[model samples]
Target: MLYKLWRSFIKEIFLLKRDIGGIVIIFVMPLLLIITITLIQDSTFRNLEGAKIPIIFIDNDHSEVSQNIKKELEGSKTFRLLTNFNEKTAQDAVFSGEYQMAIVIPENLTKDLNANVDSKVQTIVSSFGLEADSAQAQKKAPKAKELHLYFDPATNAGFKSSVMNSVNKMVFEIENKKIYKAFQEQLGTTEDIEENKNLISFKEITPLKGEKEIIPNSVQHNVPAWTLFAIFFIVVPLSINLVKEKSQGTSVRARISPTPYFVHILGKTFTYLIICIIQFLLMVAVGVFLFPYFNLPAFDVSGNMLSLIVVTLFAGLAAIGFGILLGTLAETQEQSAPFGATSVVVLAAIGGIWVPVFLMPEFMQHIAGFSPMNWGLNAYYDIILRHSSISQVSKELFLLFLFYIAMVAISIFYERKQNAV
Candidate 1:
């Protein structure tokens, strides 16, 4: 039995080696896919982080409040604040979509704010009977100052909300400082409390099991995701090869021989599993060595190498199992070729290969759980990004194993049923 299986394996290796197109499809094509996608996504990340949003700042007030707002915008380094345009021109530009948004600080904003704070402070002093000259306490509060924001019609709601929230917070802080200053003057106690900007702050942390604090980058993200895709893409060639065997009487000779059909299947699966591992190594090599030449981030494979290899093996098994099942179920090249290609694509789509599962709609995210690719992807992510130990990624790994077992079982059952007929 061992000799038979070894011969079968040797035959598969020789046949695949001679098929130049198959080698290219499994190896060269995947490398190109990963490189191209990583480059594109890296540029997108740079644009999102480093691109300055140009916003029109129409400072009709031209006072401390407007100037402070301008200072804040400039300090953020997020906006290229253009203050030259007047109300009419800025409004026109924003409405016409030449600019994403505009901020128009109302005129006399400082004066109105100061007057309102003074009147309120006087009222407080007079009510408390703490001051002799409290006649100004009766002065009515100035009408509410209006700060106008104009947005381009093409702007998304997310950008609009972010701009509005930032502006509101800034203006609210300025107003509070003014009120605090009034109280300080009325009480005759002097200390600067208004400039306390860092009184509160926020931070985000991505916890990893390892000490290395590598920033997540496009290459790290794309390499694993597309590697999973390329692994599963083996279904196409595997299924076609099976159909071709039947057409060319290869299956007939194997069946009439003393060797069992299952040995042939095992040999094919083993041969292609080796191919999957090689493909995986090629992708990682490109990310680690070649990407730096392109000025892209290098892939961080700093986690447990054993865990990474374990996950890759399970994922390869799952892909190879599905390929064998597809080949067994399909009868003709015409049927197998299109069906295998289309199935891999559809699986990739729903499996968080094309997009992250969290970004999908709720129902689609739930559906992703059924895809074997998703299970493999999650396992890969755990090992690569989270630095997860084998125990930590056991659930996804178990699911992949079960999927592989299920596919192989179904294929064996169908093959037996057909043979009995």
Candidate 2:
């Protein structure tokens, strides 16, 4: 049985060696994919964090409130304000996609803001028995004040949300400061109340491993993701080859041989699984060694190398099982190749490879939970980013192993049924 499996593996290897294109797809293309995608994403992250987003800012109020807003926005170091164009020009620019969005401060904003604050202050003072005249305390409020935000049609919801939140927070702070000053004035206070800058501070933290703090960058997140992409991509060639063998009568010849059917399955699974491991290693190597040359952060799996390999092995088996299932189910190269490739892409899309599952809609996120690729990716994240132990990643590993079993079982059942017929 061992010799039979060895012979089957040798046959598969020989056939693979003859197909130069398959070798390129298995190795070269995945390397290119990881490199290209990591570089693009890394640059985007750097730009978002380090490079200032240009925003067309129009301060129509030309007063303390608007000026303070401008000062706060600039101080955040997240935005680079463009104050050159008028509202019309800025709107046109934003619409034309020259900029992301435009902020238009309503005219008399300072005056309106002051009026609203003063009315509230007067009402509060009268409540405290400070005001002698009830008529004076009932200060008439101004008209509804509007702050206009003109966004580009192409702006994503996240960008719009971020802009709105930043602007609103600044406006809220300004209004509160004005009210505080009024309160002090009304009470005959001498010293201005010092604002508590650290009243509500936020610090983003990623999971830490004993002594090492992992600041996740593109390379660390992407290597495992695209590696799984490349692993599952083997389905295309694996399925097509199975169809080719059937078309060329190879499966018929193998069926009548002394070797058991499991040998053939094992043969292909081992061959492809080895290829998957190689693909993963190459991707990690590129991330660790080549990324620094391009000024990108290095991928570090120092403490979790064993865990990474264990998770990757299970992921490889899952991918191999899927490939075999596709190969067995598909009847022709035309049927297998395109379907295999499309299914991989679809899986990648919903599996948190193309987009993070957290970024998806609620329904899509639930659906992503079922994707085998998602299980594998989460396992990879555990080992590399989260530095989790094998026991910690057992759930994902179990899910991946279960997926592999299900795929292989379905393929075997279908094959046995067809043979009986």
Candidate 3:
């Protein structure tokens, strides 16, 4: 049995060496994708950190309070304010992806504040714009004295939240000043209000102890995501190989030998498992050495090395099992090629390889939990981001093992059924 297994493994290795296209797709393509994606994302993150968010400022009020608000925004490095922007033109620009957010200070803002009447600043988020009837559009448009903040739908939620928080703070300070001035006039005193002396204060509390900081960058995300994508993509070539063997009567020849069927299957699985490990190591090397060489963030594996290894083992097994299952079920290379390739791409997209699960819709996030790629990504993140130990990722590892077992069992059952027929 051991001899037969060894022979099968060696055969697979030689066959793979002959298949130049498969080797390039499985190894070279992933390296290129990871480098390109990481570079683009690193640049984007740097710009976001260094450059100010551009916003259109339409001050119809032109009052002292409105001017102060504008001054506050300008003083803070958070925003680059573009003034005297036409409302229609701004809205069009935002919708067309030229801008992220727009702020409109309404008319009579100061007058309403002086009278102690409640006034709303209109926020016209570009996301709110949609094709609608004239009456509906008119009804949805910003009313008088409303401060409208228009936001693009495609903008990152975290970025939008940060911008909103800053805007709200500015508005709060403006209101607080007006109220303080009113109180001073009523009390016949001209005392100035001190900074940061508001009635309410906010404090942030974090769960992490000590000064350990975990700042994950694009390298941390893309390396594991594209790795999983590449691993699963092996299904295409693997299925093709299996179909070719069956068409050439290799299966029948193997059955006639003294080796058990499980040995043959295990041999194939073992060969692919080794391939996956090598692929993973090559990708990790890129993250560790190549990224930092280009002035980009490198993979920070501050967690237990044992934990990373255990998760990676199970992830490779799960991916290999899936490939084997596809190989067994496929009747021909033509049928399996498209099915394997398309399924891997679709699963990767759904499993947060293409986008973070947090950024996905609520329904999609729920669906992502069931994906094998998501489980692998979660395990990797546990080690990379959380700096977790082996026990921390036990659940993810367990799920991956379960996926592997299920796929292998199904593939075996299908093979037996085909043999009987």
Candidate 4:
């Protein structure tokens, strides 16, 4: 009986053999997506590197201090000075992509600083307002005050970070001069205290720790997220095959034959399982060969063998089982396709696939815990990033095992009901 069932399953694989071209397309999709997104991300990185970060100066003061501030920036490597001081010209330059930001040293900037008074620096980046992504654009306004040091907001952390280092150094130099002068006068020494009088120097100012590393290859993030999505989408083709077999009366014929109904269903499951395995292998191969980012290591903290086996087994089981359950529940291609696609997208978005959970709201982060993406990602992190063993992921592995069991149970029940009539 087992031999017959195995033969039947092998027969089914060839019976509804998928179009070679279609299989090729499906297998290639993930790799193509990886390549395209990686290119875009790399291009953005390149554009940000050598391309000039242009800033327009609007100095309303026309004073020595304001001019000095302008020179200080133009002399530094942080920005290129675009010669558009007026608001209209600078705004136009920004909108036209000729400049990234504008620095407005408001009227009487020097007078305010020298007098120990408060003043505001007006920084403008494209009229579209601040791109939360561009630290350079958001910082031009604050860099305006680095020349005088006292009036800067110090609120924008990046701007404050760089400014603070310069300010610390300047303060130390000033204090050293004062100390040297006092000592020289007291000792009646003729030594010069003009240039080299350096006092307490800032060794290093560490920026805030745990700043999220920017993903250089966006595909590293996108590919895994979208692959999960495509796996969900595979349910459409699977379900359509089921319904098609039923409509053509082949399923009824199989039921009446020596093959048990369960064996017939097993055949269908095998078909999809083979396809999925092939899809996985092809995607991984392409990622490793073409993309240079495939085969993210499995987490393994302790040297335990059994735990690692369990984690991989349960994860694969859950993913495949979910695909099967979704296929069984769907009645038609049109109905299944959209649902499958949308479900993947929604689940990925919620699961911290697109944007990491840390960036999401507190409530959303909690909600993401329920998604398979979260479980999958956590498992991946444990294996790939954390180097954890399967036993270390007992909670996640168990949850996936349970999910697989539930899905299989539901599929069996549903198929039985449909066959009973």
Q: Cα-based RMSD of the predictions, in order? A: 2.7, 2.0, 9.1, 11.7
Scored against the true structure, residue 376 in model 1 reaches a CA lDDT of 86
Which wins on TM-score, candidate 1 or candidate 2? 2
lDDT of each: 0.86, 0.87, 0.80, 0.58
TM-score ranking of the models: 2, 1, 3, 4
Model 1 gets an lDDT of 0.86
Evaluate candidate 1 by giving its C-alpha RMSD to the native, one decimal. Answer: 2.7
Better of 3 and 4 by TM-score: 3
Candidate 4 segments whose C-alpha is farther than 4 A from its true place: 20-22, 61-78, 91-100, 117-223, 254-271, 292-316
Per-residue lDDT of model 1, residues 1-421, tens digit only:
9899899999888777777877787888899999898888888878878988888888878889889999999988579889888999988998988998888889999888888888988888878888835667777888998888999998888888988899999988888988888888889988889556766699877674458565677887788899998999888888878877878889889878999888998898788888888888888889889999989988878645668778888999999899889988999978987898899999999999898899899999999999989998888887787677899989999999898889889988987887674
By lDDT, the candidates rank as: 2, 1, 3, 4
Looking at model 2, the pairs that clash are none
Off by over 4 Å in 1: 84-97, 123-127, 132-146, 150-157, 194-198, 205-212
Question: What TM-score would each prediction reach against the true structure?
Answer: 0.89, 0.94, 0.85, 0.66
Q: Which ten-residue region of model 4 has the weakest summed lDDT?
A: 116-125
User: Which predicted model would earn the best TM-score?
Assistant: 2
lDDT (0-100) at residue 214 of candidate 1? 53
Q: Write model 3 residue lDDT over 220-263, tens digit each, in one string.
A: 88888888888887887788888878898988887777888778
Q: Candidate 3: lDDT of 320?
A: 79
